[model samples]
Target: MTVYRRGLRFLRARRRAVAALAAWSVVEAGQTFLVGYALARALDEGFLAGRARTGLGWLGVGALAVVVGAYGTRRVYGCVAALVEPLRDQLVRHVVARGVREGDGGALSGLTQQVEIARDTFAGLVMVSRSFLFTAAGALIGLCSLDPLLLLVVAPPLAAGVALFALTLRPLARRQEAFLVADEEIAAHLGGICPALRDITAAGAEALVTADAGARIGVELRAARSLARRGVLRVACLAVGGQLPLVLLLATAPGLLAHGVTPGALVGALAYVTQSLLPALQNLVHGLGTSGSRLEVVLRRLTPDPPPAAAGPAVTRQAAGPTAGGPARPAAQPRPLGVPVCADHPPARGPALSVSALTFAYGPGAVPVIENLDLRVPRGAHLAVVGPSGIGKSTLVALVAGLLEPTSGTIRVLGQPVRGRAAHGRTARGGSARIQPVRGPTACGQRVLIPQEAYVVTGTLAENLGQLRPRPVPEAELRAAAEAVGLGRLMERLGGPAAEVDPRALSAGERQLIALTRAYLSYAPLALLDEATCHLDPEAEERAERAFAARPGGTLVVVAHRISSARRAARVLVLDGRRALLGDHDELVERSPLYRELTGSWSRADSKPALAPRDPDRVDPVAGPGLAGDRRHVVAHGPVGQMQAARDLGDGGTRGREG
Candidate 1:
């Protein structure tokens, strides 16, 4: 659906509140006319008839009713606005949640602007406009009821005034739309520049960036001036268009009175004409001026309503091949491929992870990022995924973490499917991330993935560390996480992260360390470190690695580019062209060419020959939990035996390369 249609849906959702506000608006308008007429009549007839006190009392009663109506209307207005807040928040949350998976931009900012505009204009100014309309309608109806002939004199000019105002303001509306778009561009430009101004200075490109900003501003200024001109011309047209006919009416009023129109009727007709024409003309001008931009923004923000929720694989079947048949049977749900089974539920303990036939692509047609990728990470294992850049190493981590869905595969963390990204194959920006955040009661507090980039929110360091509100982590625990990542000294060097005062005050490394602390706080059974220590020094990186290794019960999946990190891994999976070459630190180093080239030493333990498999049914004591339980399993088949078996499957085979 288009944004405009979605906006209408939003309005429809809050119809009751809107209706309440609209009802009061009409009541206020009618009362306003009544009070005006009553006062006018009291002065003209009662005072002129020498009954001043009675006339005054009649005016007071009319004034009192108007006061009460307006007061009640204002109260109702507040209630309507309050009711609309949740609707606005819901719209924003939808956009934010979608953005996490889809990486779509502009929706969040536009939603904020639209809701604020609605609160300021639609929720408030609309009441006034509606009041004006109803008030004018009542006065015009009363005037016509008193004397139908008077319409002939007032109707033509008022219609002309409205028509003329509309004609002149059409251009203004188009210009305003263009101007508003340019204004948004300028805001985005400034926002981009503000945070990274130091880089421009360091690079000596300040003049170039400043010139770019100036050019954009110049464009905005020109459009803004054009809008101003249109506004002025519209106001001028309203003045002349409204006044010319009113002047004629006033000039003819006395003559009309003498020509058999009663003076009281003439007076009332003139009052109605003035009241009816002026506000209508003003509203026509204002509507053309304001509504277009507000609406354009509102329409841009609202996404199409989602299709109805479907059950399990049925949903995917409907999405994948709708014409194929009746509802497709749900795919056999696999157990976890990694630990920290639940993000919300506190885990009994972290567990090691394993995957088989883990294959996934972006879509049906694209080549898979991971293809039949298989790995066995023992319980409490600290393994690193080392590959040349762009080798799908990080993507593998994402898949294992359940952040991406496999095209054909199974991942078992402590013998359960990953609860995060993998199960549904969703990215953060597509609005699916929130669902993955809490998968099931048995799945909570199972695993945490530390992304490559660091994020710091606008609050205290404590706030940034624990995304969950009411901050479950204590100061001591937070300090320990900081120290474990070797950021404790950095914190002290910077005078304490808790008192660091601002995220801006820290460097990129410090920010990344803080993010590490956040992941550590999650205490998941499996921690997938996707370049999580990319920012730390060698000593600090080792310190962070130890922290991951020491985490209770969870297996550690580390994706690293640095050879130092690879050497530290108990087992390293070398990926090249989306295929996995798995072996221990020493075994892979000697046999795999890619390992040697990356580490630059054939004799290094990281470059050892791939290990030959041992006999079937001979379990290593260190392997823990064997092939049967929640722990990762090395199949009883010898290394060479399993390797041949995997090759015979006719899927991609694991091959060690000579550098």
Candidate 2:
């Protein structure tokens, strides 16, 4: 009902054009009856009485009616354009807005394919429906004028055929919906697997992947076949309803002739049945059955139902600390490291980061990778996240960044919600604000994310770094930022900040450094580095992290790739799939067996066993108070001293890190 009303509203804007079209449709329908009447006159008043001149006059009038009907048909197309183009524009706008809000690329398919189908189908439906109504009315009236009893002979079978065709409508629509679903499934499967083809082949899983894609294709084929079978029933209904009326009229002709039905009137009745009534019914059935079904499917998808709310009250549990049983508890309410607790809510202060009752899965019915997770990071805090490979570390970052939506949960950055499906945020000042799902600064210079691989477009080095800013960055400021993040040498080599350089020519580490410099220059208060420094040397990595953390009111969340990173952070979060353990590096080493195992593994892999050990009681060479305590001393001397400290720890310091 909503879709119908909306479509009607669009049409109403062009009511003058529609009125013109309706007037033409009436003229066109009346011409058909006029032609039949003129022919009947020619036969009865002139040809039957053997008067050549009278018959010729009537035949000329019929030819004139044909010309008028042709003109009306030509004018109707112009009216259709006035109605359909606005509808297309409106649909495009709607699809674009929805796509941006949801971070969905699938809306492109609707804009390109489905929108055209709706436009063309809707126009055809309007034309065919109007023509059918007008033509059927004119044909029935002509039959009654020819012989009052003709209605009794023709109307019953035509009504039965229309009713039967209507009966098949629901089934036909269901098949269409099924076919469309199968087609989208095939497209999504292929799109997902195509980028990973090299990996599938290298892993000797090509055949398995191909088999899965083949199954989706098979489902699409079956759906198409089912839809075709239902379409054949529409053709059958048209024949039974349209052609049967003609057959009945012909069969009863002889009996009618004996009961004072003149040959001229009988011929006119045949013309009304063949030329106007049957053809109009046939067109109506095909138009409504096919186009009407397609329109319904497209509208339903464009305006899908809202997602259901969270199943129960928000699950609050601590994300860290020991339990009563002497083992770390699996969950707990997330409390800020240094904030006064309020009776109803924590006071919004600093660069806030909060996640509550977060859960996510790839598809409905798939096992959740991250479930019921909660965490809070206070303003200006540097927190490192550590987890085993495939334990949902990157997924967690993506959800918080608003690159992907959670099945159910909320992510707040700087106290403003990062928008996603079923997620909403409040501003730091305690007012509601809906943040867009884009990867840039939100309200309050909120956040930015740098992935492992940096993105560099073809432009001057300064342009790439300053892309996040609204205006161009000054040369001196760019140079200082480059020096701070260890990009000074690269900038000098490239012939200053204005030099044009292909991002592809740079090494992975250099690109990461460039990205780090960009993030450093951004006003965003919360910076998420997802192994963004994996390619840089330890000295370069530390310099970049320190530069970002030193920013005013800035908070840092690093998906740590090394134990040293966790040690450098004020706090560390160890996600092991089953649960999360949050605490400072020293406390985590004693309470989290997973954290100790990861550090021990790093020590062995780097051949620096003496630096990091399994026992927490040992004086750890890399993270012990002696070396960790010297961080402030090293930073006080400026970039040169920070670079020197990073170089000393570069090799055999921390290795075999995991995301």
Candidate 3:
């Protein structure tokens, strides 16, 4: 129904062309009727009465009608072009707009593949639908004029065939939609894996990838076969509807003659069945069956719900809370130190981060990973978040970074509320609730997030480092930031910032260090590091953490992978799957069992530390002398560095004994 409405609207926009098409269709239908009438006169008045000249004269008039009909058909094609082109343009504009808003690859497929299908299908549908209507009307009139009894014999069967065909339309459309969905899934799967082929090969996972692709292909194959089965039913309907009427007329001719049906009228009736009714019905079955369904699907996708308002009363409630209405209630009272507060409390002025009653789940029915969580970090605060693997640490960070939408809540950064939907009572409602990525001054230059695995593109070191900046950073600043993160030696070895390097050539630790330096130079007001230093040595990790925290007016939130990172932070948040505990390191060690257990396990695992304990009087090399001898030492300095150092000392002792 939407497609029909939208199509009618489009046709109205080109009213002149549609009007012309309608005029031609009328002319075409009239010509068909005149030809059948002329043939009946030729048979009855000339040939049966033995006047050959008169029969030939009637035949010539029919020939003239055919020429006029040809001209009308030509004009109809022109009108079809006028209508289809503008519709295609409208569809293209809609598809492009959706692609920009959603940034989905499926939109690209729709734009390229589905739009073309809609255009072609719509054009064919217009021509066939117009022809069927006018021709069926003209044929019915001619049958009446020829003999009213002929209508009784042919009309009932004709109507029944058409009704049967109509019944198949919905099922055929459903099958078409299913086929398209299966095809899109295959395309999406292929697109997802193409860029990861190298990693798949390195992991020796070719068989697994092949199996996955094969399964998607199998689904597409089944859908295609189902669609084909539906198409066969359409053909059966066309044959019964269009061809069966002619067979009945021929078989009943002798009985009709005895009942006062003339031979000339019977011949005319044959002409009406063959030339007008049957062909029109055939075109309707083929054109409407396939194209009508495609047009419906395409229109629904092109027209989506309008975006929800950016700010609303619900958003105000989530951000500013009950105080926005009147005086604060008893529920707004501040909790004890390190205890999470409800959203009713006014946030600290100029807070770098604020979260109020946040909750998120992967989908509507899934268990929530974060629930009624509240957090605030003042400007320049250094906070460390720690949790066991899969405790939703990454999910939390992603929500804050605007990579995922929270089911219910509000997040504000640097006093500006991040845009999203607010939770109302117990349930979350659907709206334009997704928070757009922060940008401009509000984003605070990069708002950098360094993940556990660093990203390095194919480019010069300078270009890669300058990714966060709108313009190229000065050479001095680049060098200083690189030296601060211990990438100075690596930079020099690779021939400075201008040198091109393959990201794959660098060790994971080195890549993480480079990412750290990039963040250091970004000068973002807020930085989130999610286990970013897990691949680096303890000393290097400490230096990187200190550099980020030392940035002027910047806030740092690290998803700590080590107890050392937690100890360095002013406040630590320990997530234990079910609940989150927030406190200073010493307080959490005393009060929180999960924190104490984590630190105890860390201490046991790192019984003998390699990187010397923090002491103002002691100075250590950025990298020890044996770093080149064993790369694993550079990766982790606790146990691996000690083993490497002991091996070097053992080699020295053996040489001394030989001397």
Give me the runs in candidate 1 sitting further than 4 Å from their true place. Answer: 2-4, 10-22, 50-54, 57-61, 75-79, 103-114, 167-170, 193-211, 240-245, 269-284, 302-659
lDDT of model 1 at position 126: 51
Per-residue lDDT for 1-659 in model 1, tens only? Answer: 66557557877887877677766666665665555466557666777678888788867877786787778677666756655576567767767777786787766664667656654554444544555556556766666665656656666666676566667655776787778888889988888777656433322235557788899989889998988887787667566656665676688877776776666566666666566557655665676457755655554545555777676656332353334657665543322122222335543422467788888777899888678877777787888887654457767776766666668878777666764432422111110011112223312445566664455545556655654212355556667777666667766775554563365566545766777766666545677777666445557777877777776665678876456677888888888766679888789878787776766532233221122323233321111111111112222212211212222234544532111
Q: Which digits, one per residue and each the tens of the lDDT, describe model 2 over residues 516-575?
A: 877776656678888677656567788888877766567888987666778899989888
Ranking by lDDT: 2, 3, 1
- Candidate 1 TM-score to native: 0.42
Best by TM-score: 3
List ranges where model 3 is wrong by over 4 Å.
Answer: 11-17, 92-115, 201-215, 307-508, 512-659
Report clashes for each candidate as comma-separated counts. Answer: 54, 6, 0
| RMSD (CA, Å), each prediction | 21.1, 18.0, 16.4
Per-model TM-score versus the true fold = 0.42, 0.49, 0.51
**For model 1, how many clashes?**
54
lDDT of every model, 2 decimals: 0.59, 0.70, 0.70
User: Which model, 1 or 3, shows the larger lDDT?
Assistant: 3
